[model samples]
Target: MLVVKQALPCETVDFPLSSETQRFINICLGVPVGQGYGLTETCAGAAFSEWDDISVGRVGPPLPCCYVKLISWEEGGYRISDSPMPRGEVVIGGHSITKGYFNNEAKTNEVYKVDERGIRWFYTGDIGQFHPDGCVEIIDRKKDIVKLQHGEYVSLGKVESALQTSNYVDNIMVYADPFHSYCVALVVPPHQALEKWAQNSGISYKDIEELCHNDQAIKEVQQSLSKAAKAARLEKFEIPAKIILLPEPWTPESGLVTAALKLKREQLKAKFKDDLNKLYQ
Candidate 1:
């Protein structure tokens, strides 16, 4: 009999995982599981999945000690009161949340403001939905949700998540040109995997650079892209119509990645604008 303890919300991005995963934990632990949503600015935990609201969908309602609100993001065309389950940027207020930046008053004031109700709200930059059932569901990061030319929303984060799971992909960055109709991506293939694939396919390459440019390699990558898209259940418009495989890996030293190895979206976009243009051509 395999025993288990608590389900750490940090363990999964869309926490609580699938229904099967949740059931397995419940059977083993004799205790229910839930997800948590919070940021560094709000200490550790500000919202938790209530036992009843412990579905795979939400991180549940706000904590007892915290007050959370969703404010309309005018630019994103999101308004809280306009829809049944309107999406908006998450703003938090409570004793547990941070007061402000220590000395950077300008930086702090930009995000933290006193609303009409006299409550100081810390803009979280995370987009979310408040359910009729009292659950708070994360939609996406406010900046990551890109609206396409036809007014379709392409979630860049969701696109990246889907592509990164492919065996041929080591990393990926999905980009949406607001002026364009479709999406594009920069894919970083694992060199070792690429080498093995080339060998099995009787293809030759002088180096990773040559391999990335080769037709066969590109074909294999496209196949992987299709597979991943299907797995992630993405719509056609949300998927990248074309991709640019990078021979060189993005690094913190190059300022393409953060110290934590996460993509610096703005920097990558600036550096690869020319390459992305080619994808459209």
Candidate 2:
């Protein structure tokens, strides 16, 4: 079994890689990889890592063809202009961005706005933070922002990203109960890793459903998830208060995710209404 691979310093120009992926490349290839960032609307050319910097979580500065701005979001109660690092939802302008959505005037008008400068800015729906050195760090998606009962905003995507840093977790979905004070999760643990863990920890379960219901497994999962959340610096409210292990992979065919693997929120809620409801109770 032989494998042919590209040598050190992979040629990645118009595509952005995650910081985690970047780290893995650095370890395996022993050289930094080029990185880039953009949205589908912009033809995937907003920014790139020309410096070949292996710095984790940096997507570099905006491209010359794009005009990037971070505006204050009043509803979230946090303003980028008010912050020193300038964290806010990423807004873009320039010829690269589309004029508006096709045949959907109302939807287009909602996200596309012309500023006083006469530049049409499209709300990217992605949150990012400005670094001192001018690099952009993508935090999470704006759609994942959820408001807690205490008026605190929680980014479920960010929480999920944090929890996924654990090896035992294969996939996760964090759900915020708007009607309640805390959060919950639909967890998909790595099958082999979980089984090995159960054996080592002196726990017993015959199947995925039984494993999900195992008290010891649940306790470990909860603790590890909480630890990961804390490491990601998420607020207490953003952490899940309870979790329902599904132990099944979600695919586009499963009606839970899109072809791009983006979660379909409505479909998931409808599909797992019972599991979600049980968590609240």
Candidate 3:
């Protein structure tokens, strides 16, 4: 079998690509694959990684079509005065900005703003870190951040993204209750990876559902989750102490995710009420 190696410039839009996945793609394709950041409100053109940038994670500097700025989000623990770099809510302003929603002035007033200089700005509600190299990394979403019982702020989306990089995790949802000091996870393990692991660990199971219930399997999954969290440099409390493994994956058909494949968190919470209770217990 002859496999021809090909190199082409690639760019990912819409979703924020994980650092691990970006690096993997770069290596496998023998080309630098850049990730771009934008919102529908901004006409889908904001920041984009340079094709020559071999580094991973950042979405590069703001495009000339728009101006980017960071506003302090104290509640989410991201401030513009952060030591190593400035981190805050990313705001996009300039020509590429949307005018307003159709027939909804109230909704428009909430996120759309006009500065003293007559520049239009859109509050993206996305937390970002600006690097010295002029690149920006979208780290978390304001709506997805929660306060733990200890008053520590944790970004559920951030934690889930980090954990999803684990080989064992096919999908994951991080749950945090204000009544609890730590977070937990509902994970869907990859079938092939989980089966191979179970076999290596001398565990027996008729199917994925049976393997999900195995004590040793659960322990191994937890370890993998921890390893991924540590690798992503998540804080101590950010790590999920307990996890509930689910055999099924979350898809749009399951009502757990949107048509775009984004998680419908409220739906997940409602559907996994019992599993969540068990994890907390």
Candidate 4:
């Protein structure tokens, strides 16, 4: 009796719970679920815990069967460690560890290395920190932390999550460029929802683009976003400074979004750099 919602590649009337219309039985439905972090090289399921308010972004404590540690990466290689440190790449070892990559000794040797204690540990590229409560909070991918000109870093995941909560926002991709002062969102509104709102508000639109430019429609969308921001407890920097409604939705085939639904920040920035600049100007 579990109801699971899986991320989808395209819009669907009733979203599938697994791979391309495939459905899998989810044990933690209606009940709170736990999140875990690991990699293929680590044999997966490195750490997890029961769902809790404090564990929102946490991957929970290390598993009983496995040993986990955070190692600092220097220019050439990794630094050894044992004690629970704040933040770094996650390394796993013990009974659950995988032997090595198949027929790829070079790649295998690079990720699976032994520590001073002669224990084999698989290096997971994901970046995270040990929480004060002994859980692990995944901040972002090692590469996704965008440093702004003002020396502040923004988590693109956080901003994207906030935008996704807007009812009118069907899909969105956000990015900031070296030349821009703030981030911009390429938004695709829910056309049905927008049409209903417009009709009720007595507003007429020649097309989707015109609807987006309508003052009242814009106000409604903005208000929805403002409310969603508060509800999501988004930080000031994690909210987009401005949004541009796109004529069509971004799709994998279009190369606007990745198969995992993550925005290709570099590609998007390059494609819309001019539009983003216009916003600031």
Candidate 5:
């Protein structure tokens, strides 16, 4: 039996594997894949993928005895209201759905609304759609889609995914700045691995700061960024023309990363506002 887990968009290399180990696996072993999805509001195991390439970012069709729908909203946003649709929020209502929030009726009322039909539905914050082939493709999180200068929608996840494919990158956070033409990235490298590589290649550097400021090292990082952009299939506008190498990793103590290690994008942007301004200037 074989099991594979797709790398996260923010993860540059096989995190569980060492740099040398990853190279060996990629050269000798085949690809790896796996699937699982759940919502904090939903109990767990709401949807998942059993087959390969069913659809990217989909939680497969609803499980047996589960009900899913794409409900239309009177307001601007569309929602997975009740099923049979190509797009909308992913709402689930069935035995698996949670009844309501604890001691927070108002919060519960906002998501678990009762329709005229008297049926209960849990409004999943994720936006997605069901495919013709019976798969679900998560388009974007309700909050992750940013309108570009041209009014086109860009998925931050897509751009971040591209950046993560770079061999030199450890993790990255990509976000749009209202004042810039393109996006920007706060890049974190696998310092230990990169230092080893640098040493092995006879590229001496005093420290990470020196490496980041080194013209040749910057060029190598840029090349990795280009490769990531290509792998992610990003539009020209979506690519970050500028990247800032962070001096340190984002952590909960720094209030830059979430408990789950996800970037606190808004906070990161605000924290690096001056650096970003310098780039634009």
Candidate 6:
């Protein structure tokens, strides 16, 4: 017999969680899982979604111990004057905030600020939008953005996050080249999902590597990617024009990702230089 832990009424996530992932988790666990937004500098208590909010992608209003502010970044096209919702770089000020990084004055001076009222503020590089309900939703980041040949900027992190919600995708790394008009992706397909897809399509494959090279398999994965991107309302240029499927999972041991599972972009780009060239071709 198998045993399972009792489902609690509420669960919380600290890292970025997609709306689709959150909904799926809520359905699977039979509990309301809310997302919280905060950094280590804020003592991890900036804002949290209410369990009953029922809306996706909100990190709730600012907590009593902290206050949240948004300032415009013109280069990124985010502004406090954005209609319907205000969007800008999220700054947190409160009693519980950290002073600065230990013995890193230059780095500390870049992000930490003191207001005229003697209140301390930390300039979180995370881009956010404040909804009418006063809740904050993380929309982008200050880094990991690329400009395409057409001069339009795309946020690589946002694209990856949206596409990773696809059932066929275990992980994804989106690449953009300034010389190329379109973006391309390197996707790590879920083994079980790809196997099931192959079976359903009446395709025989000796291994995952062979299957990844199959034209039909590649087409299906691309279709899945396009569907997810459209569902997420990504702009037309933001959608990848091509993709390279990797049979192997990127791991910390592989040096493609950090211990925290964050992508090491430079390493990945270097490792797949030839593949990326082919993609552009």
Q: On residues 54-172, what C-alpha lDDT tens digit does candidate 6 reach at each position? A: 77778888988988999999988999999989999999997888999999999999999999998999999999999988999988988878888988999999999889878989889
Model 6 Cα shift for residue 202 (angstroms): 5.7
Better of 4 and 6 by lDDT: 6
lDDT (10s digit) by residue, model 1, range 83-167: 7897799988877778889999998988888768777778899888898877888877877888889998888876887777789
**Per-model TM-score versus the true fold:** 0.80, 0.87, 0.88, 0.67, 0.72, 0.85
TM-score of 3: 0.88
Which scores better on TM-score, 5 or 6? 6
* Cα misplacement distance, residue 260 of candidate 3 (Å): 4.4
Winner by lDDT between candidate 6 and candidate 5: 6
lDDT of 3 at 244: 87
| Segments in model 3 whose C-alpha atoms lie over 4 Å from true places | 1-4, 102-106, 200-202
Measured by C-alpha RMSD in angstroms, how accurate is candidate 4? 7.6
Q: Between which residue pairs do clashes occur in model 6? A: none
* lDDT for each candidate structure: 0.81, 0.80, 0.91, 0.67, 0.66, 0.90
User: Mind giving the per-residue lDDT tens digits that candidate 2 earns over 6-65?
Assistant: 565554544335677888767766777766678777767776665667787677788999
- Each prediction's RMSD to truth: 3.8, 2.8, 2.4, 7.6, 6.7, 3.0
Q: In candidate 2, which residue ranges exceed 4 Å CA deviation? A: 1-8, 11-20
Superior candidate under TM-score, 2 versus 6: 2
lDDT of 4 at 254: 80
Compute the lDDT of residue 164 as modeled in candidate 3: 85
lDDT against true structure, model 2: 0.80
Give the C-alpha lDDT of model 3: 0.91
